[model samples]
Target: MTARTARAVDVPVAGGVLRVGVWDAAPDAPTILAVHGVTSSHLAWQLLAEELPGVRIVAPDLRGRGQSNAVAGPAGMAAHADDLAAVCAHLDIAPALVVAHSMGAFVAVVFAHRHPALVRRLLLVDGGLPLSAPADLSPDELVAAILGPTAARLSMRFADTAAYLRFWRDHPAFAADWSPELEDYLVYDLVPVADGGAALRPATSYATTVEDTVDMNTRPTVTEALDDLAVPTVLVTVPRGLQNETPGLYPPAHLAALLARYPAVEHVAWPEFNHYTVVLSRRGAARLAELVTAQLSLSVA
Candidate 1:
């Protein structure tokens, strides 16, 4: 396969610059801005970007991740939505469609809610609705159980880039279908650290983690925000999220309710996908692109 030329640019935002990746093809084609999950960067959409053709694809390294690490000021979805608005304005392209993965999906929903004028449609991959916790549990306990491993991974300063790639390969979710593109993604996500070592720079800080946990519980508010969303939207869910029973982790039921609430919402559940692979897997990426294309085609027709 020929390597497509990709460009990285930083667009100024409120507190800092938002790093954006452009997969430019045809200017007349519809534009799609990809919002990555928490602790993810523009590379999150690598596989999916490759599949989508003839479109101006904008993948922004959300605040505090990848090249956008400096724009970590936003504590919740609202803040991210605003940052996205700024980036869209900078690009001078109206929001064509938004395809968001995981936490990026949450930010995309909030963005569409806040700036309806910009978004023509929304494709939420394994995200969109907020996380939920048992009424009895404390947020601290929930976060530690659900996100502690991720926090630990980000904190690790790898001795070399290859070691980091190995770490991802050994992971339960990604081990089965690891590829060269994923290797490039892992390398891009890392930065050289002091003491002649490298580390993940877009590490989700404690503040951001806590903020996300809190925001996850704000599904009601997000629903209210989406109540009047004029833009069409779809939610794509993975099997792990629905079947896995890791305590303290957010459940898929919350997302179901959100889908039920919106007249314009559509939901798809793929049993073959895990939380991460829903956007990374070839089938999953094809499914995601198909959904977005189908929606856009319907709109244009």
Candidate 2:
């Protein structure tokens, strides 16, 4: 087995630079693009990158999240889609398989729609379809309804990495699944803040999350992309939600309705994994690696 060497690169985008993590393999290794969930960075794919020994994985921090939070302009699915295209061009690794989790899945859809030639197939984990919510909810309630604690954490300021780690360790989604990798991922999400003290805060922007979240559920961008899905797509869903709650992001009945609408998109129901564990845990990474490996064996051209 080869050691996976990971490195970060800053690629120029519209407003600011996009931070990309490249898990390097052999020169001729198969390359695949990865997209992380809302409020997540390229580090979210670390465990999965290790599981794939001979493949190159390129992932970027979407604008308004992680290191790219400095990126100016409104955050939406189309904007993220364009940034991903820019990442591919900057690295010269286009036309690869896309493995995206949560909001990344939605971005992957728009990516495929906006840059069809750059996408081979899409592997959506625990997301991709619109997650319908009550239309009467206020903006705050809407973000809270979909993101749960994930959104609330954005507003919090921590004293340091240890403080942030403690906060995440208490999270139900990561409590029993704690690992060094999980710690590293959590630590990377924090940046120093100036709240009259040495406080640290998550790199994700709450306003940007609100914007992206609303666009994902209620905007025509997702609808238009789904209407014109032109590549091979496989949607893999988990049975649990972010807080280890049952029914996850895509409940069976709701997902069934979505699948019915986009009949060509294949669905794979994976049991015993929560939304975060689907990409955060080691076992989950191995299973997802198997799926990506299978897709690599096929020719999308």
Give the best candidate by lDDT.
Answer: 2
- Expressed as tens digits, the lDDT of each residue in 1-301 for candidate 2 is 2346569899999888999989987888889999999999998988898899888999999998888989998789999999999999999997469999999999999999999989989999988888967797777899999888889989898888888887887889876778888888888888877555789999998999999998988779998999999888999998999999987888789888999999999999889789999899988988998999998888432
Q: In terms of TM-score, which candidate is strongest?
A: 2
Residues 113-178 of candidate 1: C-alpha lDDT, one tens digit per residue: 898888888888876765555555576666665555665576677767777777777677675667
RMSD of each: 2.9, 1.4
lDDT, residue 81, model 2: 95
Per-candidate Cα lDDT values, in order, are 0.72, 0.89
Q: Which stretch of 10 consecutive residues in model 1 shows the poorest summed lDDT?
A: 241-250
lDDT of residue 31 for candidate 1: 82
